[model samples]
Target: MTERRMVAAIDTSLVATAAAAFSVLCASTSFAGVLADSRWVFPALLVVVVVAALGVLGRRLHWPLYATASTQVAGVLVVLSSQFAEHAVLGLLPGPAAISELGELLSGAADVVRTGVPPVPAEPALQALVCLGLGLVAIVVDLVVVGLRSPAVSGLLLLCVFAIPASLSDTMLPWWTFVAGGVGFAVLLASGGQHRRWRRHEDREQVTRALFGPTSTAVAGTAGVIALLTGVVFTGVGTEGRLPGSVPEQFGGTDGIGLQPFTSLRGQLNRDKEVELFRVRGLKEPTYLRALTLRKFDPERGWELEGLTQGVEANAQLPLPEGTDIGEGDAQRVEIQPIGYRDPWLPVFGVPRFLSGMGVNWRYDPASGIVFTQTNQESRPYVQQLVVPKPTPEQLRDARGPMRVAPEYLDTTGIPPQVTDLAQRLTADAGTEFDKAVALNRYFTDPSNGFRYDLQTAPAGGGDALSEFLFRGKRGFCEQYASSMAALLRAVGIPSRVAIGFTAGYRQGDERVITTEDAHAWVEAYFPGWGWQTFDPTPLSDGRSALPQYLNSELHPAQQPSSAPDPAQPSTPPTDGSTPGGGPQDDQGARPAPVDPRETEQSNPWPIAIGVLVLALALLAAPAVVREVRRRQRVRAISGGAAGSAGLAWQEVLDEFRDRGAQPAATDTARQVATKLLEHHALDESGAKAMRALVVAVEREWYSANGRSDESLPETLRTVLDSLRRASPLDLRSRAFPRSVLQLLRPQP
Candidate 1:
């Protein structure tokens, strides 16, 4: 009868543990706001179910805790490996190659974590990560609840799962997640009582009735409601001063839409208004007015502007270019007047030799030829004396090769494999870097490649966006063309960067008027002797595109007429800007020009840091802290003369002995256990006397009818605890992480 009861008790605890773990896993579905869809949730759920099923099977087979845990972990690894990287493994089991492939997927997931915003794409890598993370959590939770019979200790593990989406999301998690967790915790607490009573040989009928009783259900329901309300109040109050806690719900919808420098440009081109931005004077032919240069490229965000690392405050005459040789038709004096335009970057015609009519607030980066100011230049028109390097076709073709430049310009780190392969194949026969660059430009501009200049394609996400644009969609405005060609140039070992500005608008009276519709993005490749030469890959039929004379000489016939858009035609002009309606704009529909993609939206790192810290503390400090708290509560109960005080003190002594590597058998009397501990550690007279006193008090409280509480039990218990601790290792590992506490935190099979 006793053996049967013990078996039954283990089965009851296993069921409770599995139920609690699954409930917490369901609450994790709040990640739907952070991921693109609910597909990831299914994989995470499978992980928890596998762990729970293995636990049941392990109990039936009478396997040790470690064997059960090991089997569950192996099962999870095999399932994920088969699902994600089956080719890498030799058979059903995971090998090093499979692990490496899974690691690469995790690296991809890290990239998405860094560069992507909320509703990030649910790629294979992220799905695998979700599976691995939740699966391990389920294993730890099962061990803590069933192996150690400490269901309350599992709360910390469940909180970590809840924290993932809560920390990453730009909005509040769905309320149902909290409710599910609260109800699960309540069930865990109720079932734990029943498990404990059944193990103590209580009547089976009474234990079952207590667990499933009407009063128990009502109490659990009330506790769950209280927990949910308390959690909401604390969570909302704690993060209120931080970012998303204060952000409105509507703002979160645009988070991971991959806003680029050209999305705004597309919106501007679509607007019906022909708002005049700038009026320019002084050029014999139309040329692009340079505003800002985007030197860094992100596979997801596209070309992004970066802060000026080295530059001087703008003055009358800026330093001249060092290695660039000025061609015959290089120098020109240009005057730019901003009318409706409002931007921080000043638009200049070419390589600036001298700049005037701007204050000290304007700074110029010499290497990039970008002029920026603290405030909008709408009221501050400037003049630039320029040396626009119009290298001839003969000169460009004879240039040695790509020159050594900043690593950022040559960075092709995250470019898609397909893009790199395509670039290599296209440039195979080319002799010089200039020829390779020209081939890439021609590839985009060639109508046979099926590239079209359309502004209607929806934005794409993930690192494969460039591949889609080049081989699949084949249609986008200047943003796609310039960004793709730049990526291609970098892949072929030619240092390349993107320039965002406006093309010289049509002639209006004596001055050329630049409108919001003329915003454009084009590629500039570094040539050995010629410096950075312009390459426009966008196939524009609207006449706003201005190809450099050198590119036209090399890529087109001498008498092609440049295919200018008719002056009378109401054609759409190309623009390179960021997301519209995302920020403040003027009446002309121009938002402040977007900064580098890195600077577009600065996220606060504190929430992520805090979440990480909390998880670490939970893992490293939770066991120690919980153990200390329970010890103090028992000590206080003895001091206050509470009923069952002597039994609580006796339990504390046994726990202390267990922590010090001593285990007393259940059949041993209190005196026998005390005598064995006294002899095993060779305790001094003081420790021996305290152990004898505790043994006496426990026996008196249990066997005597009076059931007297002993006032000296707390001090006696402390004396016995100190003696055991002193004989132990005397290190942080011994005190902070005692074996008794570790059994509750460590994962069992």
Candidate 2:
């Protein structure tokens, strides 16, 4: 092959390599449904880019294939070491210490994989695994595209990333992610060049190239169609509304709802818009709705439900919670209508005694306080005759524990030392378990304790995230408060479990509308005589958050009422007494004064506003900027008077045609492309003359034995471009977002 032809081949391979890398990156976006945030995306993206860059550099240096692949691995190791490993040889190399730390992170990630639910926390270990996995995928894609020159085979490797979350999680992958992967695959196929073939006739002195060559058009088109069909499938197909690891159909709601109950709870609260999940009628008083009770707690994994248990049918009469007497609590009637919540687990106000209007698929596990079904509960509406226990402070203080509850509730095997120390210190003066529970709840709600309600907490660092929330970082949402408080209660020998559900939402009209924003987590401690008592340690700023009457010291001992509403009185709307800032308020609607002047001062908004505006404008102009830069680079190349100047000039014309949304077939020859451009744009005599001359120059550069430079080729290309621009003036949208630059984002014609 000639020198110019060799350079063109290298350029085509490099473009294909870049497209392969992009395909993997696009496929990685599907993990958003699996992980909590997009934190893993950045590390995955960084490692892929590093791998592609090293592959390109190795190709340019003409290294052996093994040497190039090895270099790519080394580059990934260096990146992983910098991101996750603590110590390195020179801060850039992966040493023994770095490798050891990497092994530890991988081990932790394995544990996460086994126990974590969808939308699991994006910890350091998970992020490190993402980087390493994507880096390996990038290396494979690079090798297949650049070394073997087969872009189609590399797509199969990219499919592994897309298929992982789809097969693992019960939730469907987002539709746009599939579209992105399709577009990337299409670009890969388009960049793979057509092969050339020559035939010589005995009668003729000069050899003639074939009129048409095989191209990747059919393969790319098939891939594009498949991607579109997959996107439609993702949108049109409906899931059965079952979460991963749900209980078997025989036993109602078993251990299927495993560890990481807090993951879904936190995800629901972090949504940008609040969606109403349920509407409850005849709720006599405000109370927290219970969906599922988590009895098992692991310091590394947080709260979880217990193992499988035999359950009874939920449509008939139900037994009271374990260790509870028949007539110890007040009986109340309420009706709950499911709205947007589609999970299998059903929501109830309190311990259910008699349930009506439930199907056979629904089962009740009385021991764990959970009612679940084999199918979705979106259209299911049920009535409950449940009982709410009311206990006074004096009774709780005097009642002694019989210790009849499950051992799982009191198991403190994984409780951290910090939690034990804090619990002991806070409850040392208290004489009874009830007093110690009150002290712990008071410590969480106290403003002096530096605990505040913030959805966006400090970024998770190494070590235990719960410990960090308890001692170093005190600001967090409901899950943090509830989990930390439950851990502390367990550390102090009080049998406690975390309850996952919603708060008493504000009344809309006759019914209480509970939205995703009302989703809350609280500590439910099991007292031997009283059974279970509800306590919310989260310092919610809203007035809807009310403590039980027993926890309220302001109420008289004899006048204390049940937390559940009375069956005799009419239901009324709760009062709205939220403060300006998210500060806790008393029952009388009074907020505590700010302790620091800085807390009272408001932050300026101008800087962030200006920065956002600037970023928006830049993004809007990105296509035009990139197109202009590419044109300048090609024009400079033509001006250099090199051997491939004619090829560069022809590429400029092709880009102009692409900008006008004209896609010529890959089989079109140089002269054929010039003819198409001339006829489509209806150029004048001067432009036509320039176009014909440039085509001849390109043909000569490709076919001639002694290839000569065309000094006037740059000027000729510019003349043709000016004529085309004048004949078909681009609209503002077309110019700013040029098709030439954005064609890779959509399917080709």
Candidate 3:
């Protein structure tokens, strides 16, 4: 009966332990997820994790979980832990962000790492990775704690349960399961209680089997369904979503419809804006701008810019196939930087000689000349390339296309006609297309004429964006310049369009991998014979946007560094004649003399003496401290009389010696273990005076008592140790003659 009760107690303890561990896991996971979601909440997340760790330990001791419903809730808590992890977190942890949002984080990391891994970008994805790892360990412990309660198979089942989440985040599990399960089963064979448990656990076996019976059919069916759905979604979303998490929910609409933000997580996630991704293919990447369809602007039902869809039919405008959309022209590649496409209506570089990318399923509008994708903001990371036509300046100068004037163009295009008139006036004086391009380019670049380009960082004027740019603001970013220029050119009876893309950025040794900071926008004008001519109007005035360096860097994850973003910059032009991102301009002819080495050294005493002192202390003190610590540990390990030995007192003595600098290296074999003393380890010239007492005690023990001073062993040991230390390695080496005479004396004795 007692044996049966003990067995029952063990079984109960195991269940309780597993449940308790699960509770800790859930609580910790939920809090961690929260921190991972919002980096600022990390401290709170850490605290919860520590608390949960304590609970995990307590659970391993078999704390019961049948206490309340709160216990069950604890298991679920883990699902929500780790919130708002930064992109840099990925690099720091073995585990990655969940499959849902990791695409952008990791790919961004991969890109950052690619550009000379040495000066790495400081991204937050690495921290998120650590959280991922910790969460997994906690989950595993919870399972193993339970499994150990019964047979080893129980451990496997527990592992499978915990694995569900790990697999959800990092899906390389089938292999891990095979390896881990194999090793575990191998060990199960060695357990001695299995035979007895198998005979006695008939009831438990039945219960376990019933709860987790064969679901091969269900598993097979799930695989089939997943495969079919995956195929359909793939066909619908396009190649842009090759990486998981690449597709945002906003991009998954049908043939006529398109992708939009995932409304299901409205409160859980904030999809403030769609990320702008650019791709260049062919001649050069003409900037690809997302055409905003503006029909019903409700200020509340999201922006109504232009061409958005409402369904899913796996359809978007495919690129103009090899022989479509063009009559021969120079080979070229059009680059696109898709800003948030407010509506489905897409903007392009005049004639999109070819089109294929995310949201490319919309029907082309011949009247307005817009080709919108059938998807919304959350569908995918969009990047498309095309062989866009580039016309020569000579061709564009003599070309005039049929003009159509619609006052309603103001409403449909949502732009004022005055903006277009400006373009015409700007180009009126030019004789050739090239001349016009040169004139516009020169007007913007002239140093005397102070127009500048910068991404607006300050608070904006209330109301319409158009008014804000024309009257209230003197400086505009690349998009603003491109838009105004296009409007101006179009008004001059010229078929022109605004395009968005990255401008040429710093290119090293040849890989040509573009960075997020390179995101840019420009303009393209249609010409009669040659094709479309590209023109840049944004004055490269010196003012860098105060974006954190990483946000604009190709090196690290998008982590904001402390030095970035000049927050104190005022909006008005500086009296100093320098631009915002450019800093206070300096005279070009300044130079300075080189510094003297002696003066440089004089300024830094801490770096010289202090650094040396610290290093010396570490090297000289470590071995002694380690040895004493080891000796103390041994004292603690032994019992009774051995424990009462002078080991503890000697440890204290060693510590004092170290404090006074009598440190010995572990590799230093014992030699004149004595004179290391007189020259060093002693209390001044009292060294020999002090040495007399110790030598006499050792002599008596050695000669008269046969090396045994049982009653005074501790005192004798301490004295001999002190003398040995006095012998000093330096003194011993120099005093070899005395050592030879001492050897003769020993023989006589």
Candidate 4:
């Protein structure tokens, strides 16, 4: 009867300790991140599995504490593996083009994880590797406790059991993760006494030993290689978005409703490579592309707009520094273009002067050559001025020493050999890296290759996608062309990344309407001090890459004077060549039908107000939650059940023993009040055993502290009183407890 009671007490204490730990964990986890790119129902169902596992262990199936914990832990690992398969794991590529290709392929698999449906990314190679390596490692560690019977090993396993919650999801609420996490925590609580002793075990070792064999290793290696190589292909896809100066030419939008439900811009972004939405002509030196500054990175799969903390320096608003060498340049006009893309972000060259005729939120970053808009840049064109320097080719090349990479950029973008090989092949005869880089770009971008500007492509070949492009499918897009070039280059060892943008200005009249159709992707190579230089290797685009070309009614009259000139004439206005929208030709002067500021001001304020109000209401409801929580706790205590002061002490001891999160050390057990007399807090073997004795008493007799209720509390108190008779009280006892509970004090060692 005593042994049965002791076992029940241990189990109860574990449950109690887990509950407390679980509360802390839930408070810290973020469920939204997991549900963002994925469907909440998958993980919700997974959590349900854990709850069900717990329920079964308690009721019908009655699994041991270890069995319940192991099952839940396994489920969490599966969820995490599915999560990694979705987004982040592929983001480790070195370049944009590589990343895009891999991302698309994996995104297909992510579809399954999202819906909790079967048939995950079934590239047979990846599936065999899914559960063999790191997955096996986790199971082995868990088995070290279960099969090998080592408590120390078990504690380590339990500590690591939360890996999924920590690393996989963005901000998984520690609470939900604790559902599985509590099992390991429960196991840790029971890893003392003879129960914790190491013993020889077999079943788990059989699996571990099998996994270490050759077949599993090869499977793991293939998966890694594939992910790494494919990541290299799609690296540039993540950067696909609207640039400055692009106008709405069939661009996507909410059409005045809510977020994308069907045919939305949210997921359909990065469909094709054409980043350039604006253009800054006559800029001094080539600058970096600056998009929206990410305020906070949601670990799940998106970027949230944090407050605009980064802006012009406060000091800059004051008198300029003496040695700063800050100089104002001539005012240059920019012709903004709108692309058919869906994001609100607009790309631009040089610094943005201001959003002149815009009805959208926009920001400028001079450090990188970019302009960002709040809505799809393809729908509207905003005119602006820029301050820049126009440098000659020689000046740009010789102005500085050899190439240099920014210190901050080194860790993220290390050069690979494959890129270098392609660079060498492209620029074999060039004098310098810059000359070679530019020459290679020029060669590939030459007119003969038929690199026409077309969004559509003719499908070709078998399962081999890249093969179709390089050989059979000659006609291709920027993404195809860039990835092909980037892969061959990475094979050689060039520090290169895929670049996406516009070719040049598409002139309207005085200004340009850079269309979404003009979006393009190229290759960028780091040239030491020169930094990342853009290289467009697409053929037909190179023909019109420089300056604005006016599609005049009268083509160069010298080349062809009459409107009735031959079809093969170099430049002539044909009767069939009338401009599409009969609107008057436009240039950089005053724009027609300007943005009506009155309409912008007249926009209904209620929608934005309602959004703010909803957010406010959620925040206001917090206090009521706290009050309700306290009331329940109070009622439980007054019920004369297991949660009174005595029960509370018992609970505290169980928690104190677990020592999770941040806490002081566990110095004494209930029986050894005198021996420790502040002898260091560390417990020796004898002290440990003595503490274990007290644990048995509080656990079975006062099991409520361990998250279970006990009806025998009054009888347990009498039994505790009898035990106290045999113990001697110590000076420390007088100070730690209340004077009213003198009889409740335990005898010291």
Candidate 5:
């Protein structure tokens, strides 16, 4: 009868501990904002109910451990069905529609993980995924901690749950959350050990004594101290400056769906490594290779590529440029041999009239005149028949105004006041829109204006970026020049947009090798009658001198006075002092400056030093702190009551003997432990008598129906504890930092 009752008590304790551990695991989901509002309440409550029910059912039915796992899996499916069933086929189970929705939700979550920097805002799809993941983690933790009875392994699993968000993004979790979870797992381990000890005994009195014994309390106390100290150390070593935070530009590529192209342009321009992107042949002159045009300009959000028209057949011809006549264009055939380049947008020198040797998966957008592939495709050698128009300045100057163009192409909604004023002031001397554009272009390209081209300057501010660039700092790269020029044209009522692509690469033998460093940005002004005309506002002196002769001729005389002698253009000087078209060249291209490592280290060393010192000190003092705390807890239990006082005293004596290397076996009774300690150590007569007396008190407390209480029992135990410490071989270590406390706290299998 007593054995059955003890087993029942052990089962009850395991069930309670499992429930608490599950609750703690669920609570950790709040750190990722999964429970920011009431939306998580239903799922969290369901998890609690399922975990509690499974624990109790498994204990009462004496079912195998596999039964618990099966029930938890069923609970997850039911919960998912109930939450998402409205979108399913039958409205009662997860059908095709529900599965598709789940796939889309997971895909969106993946995108967020790929692109977004946390703290990620809560969306329905992300919230659902987080809740599902949290539920699964909680079930695993419960199985590991309760079913397997390995709290240390469960703690490691819980640590993984906390590490996911921390590793994915740079956001730091709260210290209190770690402490709460750690405490819950520690309590589960302590309860598991106590349960196991109870199962070892058949007498109800022995089981009760084991439940509140010094070993159980010491385990609980030591685990609590270690967990709390760990939390403190983690908090002290804050996560700031430890993580590599996300930069949107670093991941940008050919799709134009992310901020990569816009944001990464600066780094690409500043990179010293020369990586060849592609190569071109059969070109009579160097011209900019147009890739994609950004038309949707929100002053606050910067430039954006709105849409792509996909799935046009390979044989389809591209539409003519908006306001140009194809009959008056010059045709040219160029062979493009791709080096290592792979972008969604194909590079072309002019408007493509015909394409050959390209894959069938390629598509074209007639409006933007860009050819793209649906999926990321490897770059291949292709031939293109392009219509390169040589429109005269007289024709462009006679083209119609903005009234004849599409309204979408002429939007100037968010231009700042300063930008408008500057545009008006710059074009004050010009009458026609073409002349006004020429004037603005002249303003940026003219060297006398003191506009120095630099790639390392700070980025322009949002909405007022043009204003800041033009009126304040005048140093920037091609992106600032192209974007600001586009905004200026829009402000003065000209339809224009920014185009990004590679410039004319250096000529090696007959092939032009285009590298990442040749990536450039320029504006295309829309001429109502003549179509979109390319305008290079970036200065010719800044590694970009290969402009079309027609545009170059128009700006040459207008920029320099006829009375003053023209200064030689500052070009990227080549090793031989000349390039194609008599342009200045650079030696092995312009190499960016090497990065300095000491700059980061020298910025703030004091804070790092202090943090390291504090962490080291805390770690060094942890063992002593835990030992002191366990000693205080044992003292309190001895002074509390007579029913458990003798048991507590006897356990303390055993811990001292165990710490000094005279460990008692699990089946050892109080008298056996006393005899072992006496034989191991050379104790005086008084010490031996005190040890025997403490053993007698413990045995009497265990067997007697009405426990005897004595006021002097606490005093007698203190005397016995001191005598054992003096007789032990490992005296100093036992008195200072007791290893037995750590042994009890170790998770029991």
Candidate 6:
């Protein structure tokens, strides 16, 4: 094949390889969907394959680069339009109708990105957007790598393809996907340089070489290294979100809700320092202040927040708790002041009878008794009248199970098999659903079970974290215990869900201070007539008390209230007090704070592994890079005189031959080198003639005062070098790398 055609072929292959790699990278976004099936994989592959086939056909037909690129782009648009036929104008290309459809799909995708967490199920619109976006990326990559002949910029375009999914994702892309993408980008650059070299030679032969040279191989090589390194870093790091102490300014109630409620629990648990959430006064006894309830459970997704009630005016009366008697409970009044705690839901101790000192945008969910605002509200003092019910064990035992409760409450289809088995085993001896719940609660609270309450330990299991905690590690804080118990209760035909809020803070006189450290989670099991009763499965430790007196069989004497204080009157003498930091003061007597598990400083071997790989690659390629640099510098230094430059070029060609094992002695003259080339038959007749011309030019430059100014000497030398390179059996690196220069640079004895 002619050198020009060979270079074009190489460029075409490079573009195809890069497009394929980018398609694979785009597939990483599939994991962001709830379904295991990837919607974009096939469509992305189709786009790349079609573009490559058309590009090859165009090259064979000797079409202009612009024409080929335009054809490829049009092919992509046609394929996409055909793929989404319903939206296409003629069912083959994007028209006005298709444009409208694309806009709608993009809008839907935006909504999903704004409100939903990662691993969301792939809706049709989202899948369409994925296909269209990847198709466009493929076209752009083709233009940059093959048409424009700028493979380094093509690497940046590939980076854009990879970045889209990586930035939006909550987890790292798979390591293998990253590896494939990086390799593809590197290959693209390497191949492009090889093709460019062939094109330069071809152009020189045609006397049509441009003044501006092609980009250096060094530039392409450097870009490839940097692109691969970027991929490694992105795949190694996890995306950050709401954990214990990392609560964002707009906690909730925004159009864009980045963190799920369960993730918020995790964030709270992972917090290292203490910040006050809120403060409360006039409470007759300690209790957990309810914030929000997560009702939908998915085995793979954990807990999901769905179907939340829309906001209502602040003055709207809140719904009473299911199965609870409003008239029979003790009426208590309390004042709450928010500090750092920022959630749409207002923290309340019990069923709120009335709320005061709140904005009109505040809304309430009567079913869950959660008070929230439409927009993020500033922490303001609020008064609440709550009806606190003290349900007896006897009453709970008499209540019915799934048969009597709402069907929605009994949904346990998402529970894993392991959780079901563990639940049955733990509650086998119990006689009733209520008894089974109690048994499950006791199983978690018992100190003899070897379960340790830890915040830093990762929850075990692939997607079934509850099963892992129950059967394996048996370690976690409030979230684990509460979520596990809820799942267990539902498994045994009982209705249950998890509630998140804060534990009653340290009582300094009459007021209590709640800190971020006080963030807690617990289960609420539903009964036929008794309503959803609070169950604390988290074991009390580090000066923390156990389950409330009503839930535990052997209640501590100190936990019992001194008197039945009137709900309408002050329960105790109000004492003027506040937390030192406007939040809960860190008690020196409390258990040592657990380390934040997600802290980046924790030991991880990925960065080390990437570093080693990069170092090893750099070491392997250093010789070739150094040789190339030195060769360029030497040529530039001798360029002042044409004869001298030609002589230097001839000498470099001899060194290349020597390096390839056709060892011409150091004392050999240019005439002797040409004789050796002819005797070995290393070149064709024309190449042999060129070699002789090079030798004659070098002799004039070396031996004559006014040497022949052979402007064509450089071209003649290059042709000779190319011929010798083809004749030698040695690999490209052994023949082309200037190792002889290194020997000359060495200090000899």
Going through the candidates in the order shown, the clash numbers are: 10, 1, 119, 86, 6, 7
**Model 4, runs deviating above 4 Å:** 1-331, 335-344, 351-368, 373-383, 387-389, 402-419, 446-475, 483-497, 503-505, 524-533, 541-544, 547-749
Best by TM-score: 2
lDDT of 1: 0.67
lDDT of each: 0.67, 0.71, 0.36, 0.35, 0.60, 0.60
Flag regions of model 2 displaced more than 4 Å.
Answer: 1-10, 25-51, 70-135, 168-180, 193-221, 231-257, 326-330, 374-379, 398-401, 416-425, 428-431, 456-472, 554-749
Q: In terms of lDDT, which candidate is strongest? A: 2
- Candidate 2 yields a Cα-based lDDT of 0.71
Question: What TM-score does each of the candidates earn?
Answer: 0.46, 0.67, 0.33, 0.31, 0.53, 0.49
lDDT of 1 by residue, 1-749 (tens): 11111101113654566566665675566566466555466567666777887886786577999999999898789867765785546554688878877887887665555434454545567789888887888888788777777878887877777666666554566667677777676666666655665542233355455666886678667766765675565454332212232223221211322224454455345433456888887765677888877777777667776545336667767765434554345688888888866545677876787888865567777667677664322346777788777676767778774355566778888898889999999999988788899899989866567665655443443337788898787767677888999999999999888988888786776678787667778888887766777888875444566787667766777546455443444444334443111222335633333232222212546533654575576568766875775676567667888776777777777667767777776566677778888888877778788889987887777678787777778788888777766665346776778776676321100
* Model 2 lDDT per residue over 263-306, tens place: 56755654434567889988877778998888777777677777
Where does candidate 2 clash, by residue pair? Answer: 285-565
Residue-by-residue lDDT tens digits, candidate 6, 1-749: 11101000012343434544454354334344222235445555666667766775676577987888788888877766765546686666889877666666677565454433344444445566676666666666666666666767766666676776565454555555555565566555554544555432122212111211244244434544665567557644423311222223333332223335655564454343456677788877667788887776777656655445554454656566655543346688899988775555677886777888866677776655677765534547899888777766676677654344346566897788888888899989988776787788878755566666666445334546666788787877777778888888888988887888877766655677777656788888877656677887776443333254457653223545522222344333212221111111134523333334434323566533654575567667767765664456445534545324654666566556656656555455557757876677458766788888877776676677787667676567667767766666567767345455445421110
**What are the runs in model 3 whose C-alpha is more than 4 Å off?**
1-38, 42-328, 332-394, 404-449, 470-476, 487-496, 502-512, 525-533, 539-749
Candidate 3 local lDDT, 366-396, one digit each (tens): 3233454534433333333334443333444
- Pairs in steric clash, model 1: 65-749, 66-749, 68-749, 69-749, 261-577, 264-578, 265-577, 304-597, 305-596, 519-575
Q: On a 0 to 1 TM-score scale, where does candidate 5 land against the true structure? A: 0.53
Query: RMSD in angstroms, all models?
Result: 19.5, 9.7, 18.7, 23.7, 15.7, 15.0
Question: Quick one: ranking by lDDT, best first?
Answer: 2, 1, 5, 6, 3, 4
